[model samples]
Target: MSQVLIESLSATIVDLPTIRPHKLAMHTMQQQTLVIIRVRCSDGVEGIGEATTIGGLAYGNESPESIKTNLDAHFAPLLVGQDAANINAAMLRLDKVIKGNTFAKSGVESALLDAQGKRLGLPVSELLGGRVRDSLEVAWTLASGDTARDIAEAEQMLDIRRHRIFKLKIGANPVDHDLKHVIAIKKALGERASVRVDVNQYWDESQALRACQVLGDNGIDLIEQPISRINRAGQVRLNQRSPAPIMADESIESVEDAFSLAAEGAASIFALKIAKNGGPRAVLRTAQIAEAAGIALYGGTMLEGAIGTLASAHAFITLKQLTWATELFGPLLLTEEIVTEPLLYRDFALHVPRTPGLGLSLDEERLARFARH
Candidate 1:
């Protein structure tokens, strides 16, 4: 048998409309742009992945254009002649040269894993190491920015049995105002839903001190990235003071960050994101650090589409314990999909496919229509 070499790598920028204006702390997402990655092997197998961010560069360091550019110029050249089945070697090669393009690296790593899984006739979960669960409980983010509207949306999701965990996006408005909004929504939902808030590193430590107390007192389940990621000491202090457990989101830009955050006791829970940690295998390294450190885990998302969502899902399913559940509802937030069949979300959980690769196929016509020329 001959070694299957990577033939070509390509990336396409696709813009998809969202179900609504997803209001985050930094920016309002009117649409989501995905850098769809395709890696072709010498054996004629092509694997797909996605590198998506929120509100262009508002949420993360890399945007769709930058991701595509780097994938084309930097990543493709290095990966084109490498062994497609050797994900470890390929990823290490990228890390040795690339500095901090985790988003793009994640896409490339996912494509490689997808290709290997397809070639071996195994799911990405099994490729990672066998899955412990076939489905993950998905959390819904209520970012409508209206208390009543968010409550109504939660009720609708609950009514349909789609989601019972609701995470509110706060810190955009005044602390008191955001508190009132969260309290009102929590009051409306009461014990029927688990309410949480993601401050997105908007609030300072001073504001977070009081806000965290109020949220924890009012039945809020969690508080995510209350303070800035740069203020490591502040995060540590807030983690000790806050009544609700603090989850590190932006604080973790890489697996090393996860280890450092764990060592410093900055957060009790770690938000595991594939884009932030590099890729599926890389994110698992972070998960292992959290487990070793006795920190809980919550599967986070960058609001990716079907391909990215399933890729993340495949990695998440292999975990032994995901205490805080996952917010892998990115695909649901989008009004359109480029895949032939959308992912299945039922009974408040996203079901992982047992099929090979990411268990998804691109809709070429839809992809062409949505691709940004």
Candidate 2:
């Protein structure tokens, strides 16, 4: 007998002050909240998961408030008595009743797997089918703003040996103006680093082609989401014209989107974020499809903290064909860490925790310190 039983679950909204404001092409500033979920099994084992959103949830269609509400009002009730080790059964019920709030669902999923890992005396990665690799390469982000500032930030990241690859944010609505800014940053970086640009669905096909020509001349690696996420026509046109390989972020929200993008050759590489594609299983399936088609897959981020980041790290290590670099460096930006087992970075790679389960422990005290109403 498992001798394990689920107990009451709790969620909190926490405000993590950024060590420094992180700007993107879309916007800037902070005040975002993370939806943190804690689950306990009567065997003295517990697990933690987080549901995070940027710009206070409006950007994603669900905020931490609604996340907590869904966890309390629906998900928790269905799991209070189920076996902690029966993860699949629990997921069946959770998915059957809750179709939306995929972010919230991801948080609860982490808690369930966490509980399972604790009960089985294993790490969450083991429950996910064991690890294929022990570490992942990391890519640093260049926040949108002045060309000088962006170039300076890139230089600093390189000097620290923290990031070997960089994703620079562009898109000020004018193609030539943004290209000029990118050119200046590239000029400063020289030939010592690799650079990629994320337009965040801000360019039209014609403008994207023009920008690609300018960036390609400077040895840029790839262009990400240059056109609207929903604009299939624009995607096709950009794919046909782009001199650099194209990658997709916002255009991919589900496995269906993944298949569609791959079929149309809209993306040469796919950015897989667990939160963006519904859950872990969805991400794996997408990666399998992508790799099958000879497209490289890169791990992505949703600006997640320790809990979500660990989940992503685990999935990334499991994916067999993760050739592209990952950007799971959200913790490095925060003023403090919420995990007990610190995630370490060395020589531009993130070390995967070898211990059983997700290989992370929540700092309950720190969680309280940053709780926001």
Would you give me the overall lDDT of model 2?
A: 0.79
After superposition, which runs of candidate 2 have C-alpha atoms over 4 Å from their true positions? Answer: none
Candidate 1 on 204-287: residue-level lDDT in tens? 888899999999999999999999999999999999999999999999999999999999999999999999989999999999
Highest lDDT scorer: 1
Residue pairs of candidate 2 with colliding backbone atoms: 122-356, 122-357, 123-356, 123-357, 124-357, 124-358
| Residues 26-103, model 2: lDDT tens digits | 667464467788888888888787888777643566777888888899888998988777777777887787776678
Give the CA lDDT, 0 to 100, for residue 175 in model 2: 79
| Candidate 2 Cα deviation (angstroms), residue 12 | 1.2
Instruction: Highest TM-score: give the candidate number.
Output: 1
**Global lDDT of each model?**
0.94, 0.79
